[model samples]
Target: MIPSLSEATIRHHTIAQSFERGQGYYRAGSVHSLIQRGDRLLARVEGSEATDYQINVYFDQGGITRATCTCPYDYEGWCKHIVAVLLTCLNQPDRIEHRPALATLLASLNREQLETIVQNIANEQPEWMDAVEVQIALLTQSKTQKSQKAPRRTTVDPKPIERQVKRIINRYVEQWNDEPALDEIREIIQKADKFLEQGDGNNALIILGAIVRAYVQDWMNLDGSSGESGAFFEELDDALTEAILSAELTTSEFQQWQKELKNWQKEVVDYGVDSFEMSLTALQQGWEYPPLQEVLQGNITELGAWEDEAPDFADDLAWIRLKILERQGRHQEYLYLAEAEGQTDRYLQMLTKLGRSQEAIALAEQEMSTAGEAWTLAKTLRQQGELKSALNIAMQGLSLGGSNHYGLAVWASELAEGIDLEIAFQTRLKAFQLQPSLPDYLKLKELAGHRWDSLQPELLDTLRQSSSSLHAKAKAAIFLEEGLIEDAIATVTQLSSYESDIIHPVMDAAIAHRPDWVIENARPRAESIINAAQAQYYHHALNWLRRVRAAYLQLGQQEEWHRHRTALMQTHTRKHKLVAMLQQRDLT
Candidate 1:
């Protein structure tokens, strides 16, 4: 069944402009043909295009897990069409026609009927012929074919996949909009992953090798400004590494792969990324590194893969081994490997899973070093139903003061909501002190309730102490939020440079309490723009002028405002555009 959807959920997934725009589309009844098939909502939203766009929203008991639209709206979140469809669902639930899920409908059909349906679909869309062939082959695998060794490898021609990779790279090269291209490339790599998972690592290696070659060839042409390209290359490297580990390679192939991975690792590092370096180690440790075997057999006394020193990718290698063991359902070996290698997260996770909750908790307190580690275990323990323990560890980790304290505090506070008020307040208090943002302070205020008056001064002190430019906006915002108008004025005054966003709010909030300071600050900003003859920026000058006028009027100094306006008009008499703007705004 679909979860309960709300307007807040819809708005959260959409940008403000997109949400408002979607509301317009919904009001115009653009979202039509809405249908709910089990946990999926499918609809066509009429928008500014030749054809209507399709939207699919997938949900479960948790909430809307995914929402997608067949439009080119891939900036950060859901597109307008998706927003409109969800809004329609929330407001007009009766308009949604309910239908059985596709799996349920398919289950009702007999074998012959399913075959006929497949034939019809193939006739209608011949592009699905490949899937049909694969399905047929899978269902008809012979007994001899089924009786294969581990890591059964199958080969594929890399030419087509290589062409697809090159096409994706070329398309994203110009705009540096490599995110969508990365998505497409990752989809291709995921296909190889599926093949590798099914023990057909030969085809997986071919596909992964083709993708890396293409990606490395023209990677420099694409813009990595989004910081996503680095992560994309890492995924490609990881896939190549996994494929190499899984494939049964000839000795020469193994050497070549190791050498090529070293070269790829060198080439891709220009983007400040360390990729394919893992593939090198994977090749070095392929299937039979003696120490790895010893470690797997619960021998921790041996140096084990590194001789008295950890390798560059020791953690990554340990993680990879743990994943392999977990995948093969070798839980005992997984536990031993995790413990032998000091894989605290994996080891504690297994302990919790194995019903050793007290041990996991004790070990978490003693062994976890970073808040990030404790944060992860706290979440794991919470999911494992050790709520009180999770909250306690989170609070303890919060005191450790690592980079993840703010994030862990937030997680712990939410986890403690309706469970323990003091824990919630303490975590949130630490979060606000650590960050000192207005939003955090406000949320802390709500949690502090009657204790806010006592806590308010301490929060305000934190804000006052946040002198970095990074926290300037938040500091000023908290001043305004707390009705500390004079403090808001002082905060804005201290900034050496004017950021209208940080200063303007304080000015607006201080017009009644500190109009003289507003005028003193605003006039200089307005004069700088007007005097510099920046015609394009005259509107900014006008805005500052408007604020100055408001400030003077708030101070009951209208005649003073008139004198300042007339003097400014006379001084910029040659700037006809500026004068005209003043006239247009009735400041003549």
Candidate 2:
């Protein structure tokens, strides 16, 4: 069941513009084909692109665990499409069709019904039979041809995949301006990712190898010098490495792959792609390594075996082993390898997952080094109904001298609520001290309550003396939030860059209280943009000039403002779009 979500929760997760746009999308009935598969919500949203974006929102008793969309709107959090689906779930729950989990649904259906369903699906698309046939074989095929550890091989031809990669590369060869049209190649990789995710490693290997062998043979035909093609290879490297690690192989088969990849590695180095180096390392260290085997056998304390800063592939290799173990339900071995590899985050998490809270709590003291490690275990502990220990671990992690994550501290602060309000205040205060932002400032002020008056001066002083390396937005916002007009003015002025973002708010708020400051700052910043003639940022420049106009009007100096505006127009007479846009957007 999807948790009952609120409008406030939706707004909190996404930006204000996205929230408003999502509301519009929902009202316009853009959210379609809404369905509930167990605790997962699926929907298609009609968007600007011709194809509708698909969205999946997962939830449980706690809340919406995660939401994802097919749309390429990767900024900070959930995109407008995801927001619209959540909004629909919140308001129009009746529009959703709930179904049992896929496994349960299949179990309930009779064999004849399932056969009819597959037959109907194949009839809908005749070409799908090629895939359907391969799947059927995999399901019913006996293990007589190979060892039980090896993955079932697909009878699907590699010719079609190779041809697709060639077609995509040749089609986009002429348009190699900045970046090639590698979205199709990326699509091929995504197809392989599905097989790898489902543990069908050999089939994934076939798909990945087809794309790589074809693309590498022809990628140099385009403009590979621009360094854009390197990203494509990097993605290929990750998928290929995962394929290599996931697929169970005989010793002879491993050496054969290593030989092939070595040649491919040599060819790719000239293109400025180093990602394949890790893939090569992975092939060389495939699970038979002695020390790794020792760790898998629960000999964690025996660190004298292989004790150097692990090769760069150590983390990724360890993760693959841990995942394989996890999938096989070998949790104890997972713990052993995780601890031996110094994956404190995973080690403590498994302890919590196994309901050994006392073990987790006790081990956290020695095992938790970074704030990230502590946060992972703390979050797991809190989810499993261990509130006191969660808060304790969160505080311990934050107070650790090495490093701390500001976002986790804020989350920890939220978890601390109803348990110990003072600890919550302290946790939030630590977040602000770590990284001051306007939101954190407001939160701290609100939480301070009666103590705010006493806390205000020190906080303001700290911001004033803060390192210039701190985010400009954070500095400007904190100062403006407190109505410290002079402090806000100084915050923007101290920065080396034309702090227009900081200045825009400062000038708006200071037009009445400090008109002189607004005029002094706005004209130069606006002129710099106009002189550069970038055209895109003209509106931003005009925005600052409007504040200047307002400041002049406030001081009864409209005539001076008019002369300055006229001089600017006279100087840049050739920029017609700039002039027209300025007049149109109320710059007159």
Model 1 spans > 4 angstroms off? 1-156, 172-187, 190-201, 223-235, 250-256, 262-275, 302-304, 493-501, 507-588
lDDT of 1 by residue, 33-62 (tens): 998898788999998899999998875433
Q: Per-residue CA lDDT of candidate 2, range 246-293, in tens?
A: 787767877877887887888878866665776777677666667767
Every candidate's lDDT: 0.77, 0.77
Backbone clash count, each prediction separately: 0, 0
Error of 2 at 66 (Å): 5.4
Candidate 2's error at 130, in angstroms? 19
Error of 2 at 17 (Å): 4.3
Q: Which run of 10 residues does model 1 get worst, by summed lDDT?
A: 145-154
Q: How accurate is candidate 2 locally (lDDT)?
A: 0.77
* Candidate number of the best TM-score: 2
Q: Flag clash pairs in model 1.
A: none
